[model samples]
Target: MPPRTSLPRRAAKSPALRKIAVVLALVLAYQLWLVVQAQGKVGPGVGAQRDARGRFAVDVELGFAPERFHILRLQKHGRIAGTDGHVVHLRGVAPAGVDALAREYWIRHIEVPRRGS
Candidate 1:
């Protein structure tokens, strides 16, 4: 009778396969780091100022012009109060909407609007 060999055991013994696996793991780790960095773009207390309607105001500083269009698309209910250079003042943004904005790599920063000008 012939003995059956396991495919996983064979893969574990191959140096090329081990190298490929290590590279894939490193790539995945880098991707996760990027996600964390992107989410960190949101400033402290930015999401803490929800109004009675559960919407907040934020100053979204973008990396470029086209990103403004993407932000407008992501925030359908939010209105652009003003824009100074690449910074856009968005109001009526829900918590979920803010999270979505944070996930965008093109968005450089998200912060609570200041009291005055």
Candidate 2:
């Protein structure tokens, strides 16, 4: 009779290794989502439509209390049309205005109607 040999176990079958793999997967997923957002693949809002004058009425949400600098930055891009609680309405948004405002960390999300919708 020939001698028998055992094969090495797979790393995925280990409990600790499995947990590390799951965490790594989650990190990769989040990075991918950020890339999609940066490329502007994700739509902003449902009714991000332009008005008759070709102006966008955007709603800006600030998750945390905004500082003076954030307010100034937003005002530089567009006029503060109105406000409801933490949400602010912006009018006369420029072509690159949305992108500029979104760069601010204080700004949580910008809602505007998608073009040609």
Instruction: Please write out the lDDT profile of model 2 over residues 1-117, one tens digit for every residue.
Output: 976544335565678888998999999997676645544421445235666765576777877665667667789878887666677777888657776666554577777633431
Tens-digit lDDT track of model 1 for 37-111: 776798999868788998888988887754646656745748878777777888989887887777767778988
Each prediction's RMSD over C-alphas, in Å, is: 4.0, 8.6
Instruction: Tell how far residue 28 is off in model 1, in angstroms.
Output: 4.2
For candidate 1, the per-residue lDDT at 57 reads 89
Clashes of each: 0, 5
Worst 10 residues of 1 by lDDT: 65-74
- In model 2, where is the ten-residue run with the lowest total lDDT? 38-47
TM-score of structure candidate 2: 0.51
Predicted structure with the largest TM-score when compared to the true one = 1
Give per-model TM-scores: 0.65, 0.51
* Model 2: lDDT of residue 6: 44
